[model samples]
Target: MSQTIDNRQFRLARRPKGLPERDDFDLVTEPLAEAKDGEVRVAIDYISLDPAMRGWMNAGKSYIKPVGIGEVMRAGAAGTVIDSKHPDFAAGDKVSGNLGVQTHAVFPGDELRKVDTSLADLPVYLGALGMPGMTAYFGTLDVGQLAEGDVVLVSAASGAVGALVGQIAKKKGASRVVGIAGGPEKCRYVVDELGFDGVIDYKNEEINDAVRRECPDGIDLYFDNVGGEILDAALANLRLHARVAICGAISQYNVTGNVGDTGYAPRNYLSLLINRARMEGFIVFDFADRYPEAAREMAAWLSAGELKHREDIVEGFDTFPDTLLKLFTGENFGKLVLAVER
Candidate 1:
């Protein structure tokens, strides 16, 4: 900890178009700064790769600010506190926070939270034990107002948040849980492994008909992650008083246009009115303070083998840009993560 270690950082080099490419980010190395008073220096272990990061790369106002050109691309990461100058943190404490896309980070101690590796692996802290998990919890249980025996349908049902939403609904007593994934493999995993009632292979199947077939009666809750055609298809099957938790729009995140353009909007407004269903969007940060409460329940589920989490981790910080593309193409099988090496 005494000797200075080099920090490699990936900064936003320019605004991206359609989908991000390698040139959109610039990688550079610099000497790690010393931890000043009330600050801690962490040796980052893993970087979270999420579909929402694509939206943060654009040039517009969003739920979160865009990653400014030349700034380290904002990301959620976890690592060990190698050096600390604050009363609340110790040198050996593992922590999680907005550590960015870097090999090391130095920030105010208040910005990081201690991580207990005994509870889960560090990368799990970036996945099931992280924002994705919290989003699924509040979005399904609270926002979706999921009730016992409700029939639920969720888009991107095999991805990070969607996977949990489907399983949680079933555990909470949903009579049927149908998932819409991109392929046969993901569809099988969602159904056979996650205990969903059925799955629609959106990449190769007719979505509207499949949803109707899966939830013959009608869908009572729709947890949408892909917002384009899939959303419209899900809307077509909503039952009376159905609720749609708008967790994300990964399908539209990379859709860009001239500055100030509002981007892709779903064309199924009539369905919401006809069925008297509610569609609401949420940010996981809004429930930050309640994370511990949610994590405790999730841990119990994990301990009792009721919850399953999978991470598709790629190594090396150099693969940042290319690795991000895996999300849009649906190549990443689970919560994508980058294992950083120092």
Candidate 2:
């Protein structure tokens, strides 16, 4: 006789029209089944909460398919393998992948990647060493084409990706790096804690005026995480031939209405033409083949104490709905991660 295990999951109940509410999800418990051949079973420990998750819940065409109603909500998670019927993985191995929002998950072994937990904690893989880290790496270096002595500006500077973007710019020899964040505490953390050259408190300062004052030499590179007014401000102060990397637009993720109607589309886009600059959007998945290259370098930086990372972990799997709202409310100070209460 084998021991029985139960799986707890949050299934999508509706396509949210605005910010997602608890009612949009159906929390259900079901008995876990044994893994089939070529499959592995994992007990999820940490789940990533990103603004992109909001976009993934909507009904539409996107870089990835939307989570169908009644399906387990899509998520990136890290966990330890508890059972494996595959040759590549075994019990006790740590792994990370699109494990969905569940206490337990079973997937084809090929869909999961084993992570070196000796180098980083399981939750760190969901932050600085995970998707956010990769996004910052390629978005800044490849798409933004960061160059030495360039003055860089990044919005949502205290966020998971934006924080790394600013630090990477500085470490790569940017002359100066300025950040824009919502509150004084976040602004201070961006500059005092993260070593940004300067920071603008978007809550207190006029975004346009602050951007002009901070990047007096004009911005050579703008790493945009939160779009809308911040992006427009960055555009208005671009240096000659500057590059703008459109990463994730957290500011616009939850807006309702037609594509162009609800969110604030840039009013200063003409600045791109005037400055002879380039603005391009990139998905980190596009650089999937080169992830090892980025991971190795980031790991080295972390070990060398040259890179700083933070994770705002919330305990309890049942708190998923309210916990996710923290990202939109600017309450999460760093990378938002949900840790399953053991």
The candidate maximizing lDDT is 2
Candidate 1, residue 183: lDDT: 83
Estimate candidate 1's RMSD in Å: 1.6
Residues 28-62, candidate 2: write the lDDT tens digits: 99988889999999999999999888888888777
Off by over 4 Å in 2: 257-262
- Can you give the TM-score per candidate against the true fold? 0.96, 0.97
Name the candidate that leads on TM-score: 2
The lowest-lDDT stretch of 10 consecutive residues in candidate 2 is: 254-263
For model 1, the stretches where C-alpha displacement exceeds 4 angstroms are 257-264
lDDT of each: 0.88, 0.91
Residue-level lDDT for 307 in candidate 1: 92
In angstroms, the error of model 2 at 68 is: 0.4
Local distance difference test, candidate 1: 0.88
